[model samples]
Target: MHDVEAPPQERTRFQWWHHSHPTFAGITGFFAGMLFVTALPGAFVGVLRLLFSHDTAEQLFPFVLLALALPIFMLVKRKTRRFAQFMFVGMLVTALVVLGVTSLVLYFMVDA
Candidate 1:
C-alpha cells in the first residue's frame, strides 16, 4: 500500500462571538443597545436633577428604559440575524467609547 499524506487542518482566528451561539450574541447585542440608549435619557434626567431639583428618584428614573430592551430586541431580531448581531456589537463599542471619553473629560475637569 502506498503512503498517503494527510491534509492540514485550517486555523481560525480567535473571536469571542465565534464560539458563542448566534441567539446569545443577538441577545447580548440587544442588552447593550438598551444600555446605551437608556443611558442617554438617564444622563439627561441626571443633568436636570443636578441643575434644578435634587431628587435622587428622578435621576434614577431612567432605569425604567431598561425594560424597553426586550421589545426592541424582539422586533429587530425578527428582521435578520446579521443585523441584530451588528447592532449589539455596535452599541457595546459605542458605550465603551463614550465611557472612555467621559472619564477623560471628568478627569481633566476635576484637575482644572
Candidate 2:
C-alpha cells in the first residue's frame, strides 16, 4: 500500500494546537514580563509587611517566591532563542503556583 496525501481542504484547516504563532507568543511573553514585573513590588511590600505580622508574613512569602520567576526566565532567555515560549510557560506556571498556594492559605486561614 502507498501512503495517501491528506485532502487539500484538510491540510488547510486550522490546527490550533499544532503551531506556535509568533504573535501569540509575543503577546504571551509581554504579559508574562508584565506579571513578573508587577510581582516584584508586591513581593517587596509583602516582605516589609512580614516584619510586622506573622499572618501577613505567611501570606506574602509566596509572592516573594513568585517574583523569582522573572529573573529565572531572564537567565534562561539569555541562553536560548525560544525566550517567548519560555516566558509564556514560566509565567503560567508562576501564576498557577502562586495563586494555588495563596488560595489554599486563605482557605485554611478562613476555615480556622
Candidate 3:
C-alpha cells in the first residue's frame, strides 16, 4: 500500500457545486415553460397532421397565437401590479409543474 495525500479543499468543493444551483433552476424553469408553451402547438399539429393527412392551420396557429399572446398578456397584466404578480407566480408554478411532469414521463419512458 502507498501513502496518499488527501485533498480536503478539493473534496469540499466537490461536495457542492454552488455555481449550478441557481443556473440549473433558471434553466430548468426556462426550458420547462418554453417546452410547455411549444407543446401546445405540437399537440395541435400532431392531431391535425394525423387527421388531415396534410398539415395546415393547426401546424401554425397555436404557436403563432402563443407567440402573439405573450406580449398581449404582458400588456394587459401591466395594468395592475397585483395582476402582473399573480400572472408571474402562476407562470412560474406552471413551469415547475410542466418540468416535473415532463421529467417523470421521460424517466419512465427511458427506464421502460
lDDT of 1 by residue, 1-112 (tens): 9977554432233333463566655666666676656575777676667776567757666666675575456557655555456556666677788899999999999999
At residue 80, give the lDDT of candidate 3: 38
Best-performing candidate as measured by lDDT: 2
Q: In candidate 3, how many Å is residue 65 off?
A: 4.7
Best TM-score among the predictions, by candidate number: 1
Residue 40 displacement (Å), model 3: 8.6
Q: Which of 2 and 3 is ahead in lDDT?
A: 2
Of 1 and 3, the candidate ranking higher by TM-score: 1
Instruction: Report, for every candidate in turn, its global Cα lDDT versus the true structure.
Output: 0.64, 0.66, 0.58
TM-score of each: 0.40, 0.34, 0.39
Query: Model 2 over residues 30-99: C-alpha lDDT tens digits?
Result: 5765576467667687667858686776666666676566556665664433555656566777778778
Which 10-residue window in model 3 sums to the lowest lDDT? 78-87
Candidate 3 structure quality by residue, lDDT tens digits, 68-97: 466346547544333334444545677678
What ranges in model 1 sit over 4 Å off?
A: 1-60, 75-79
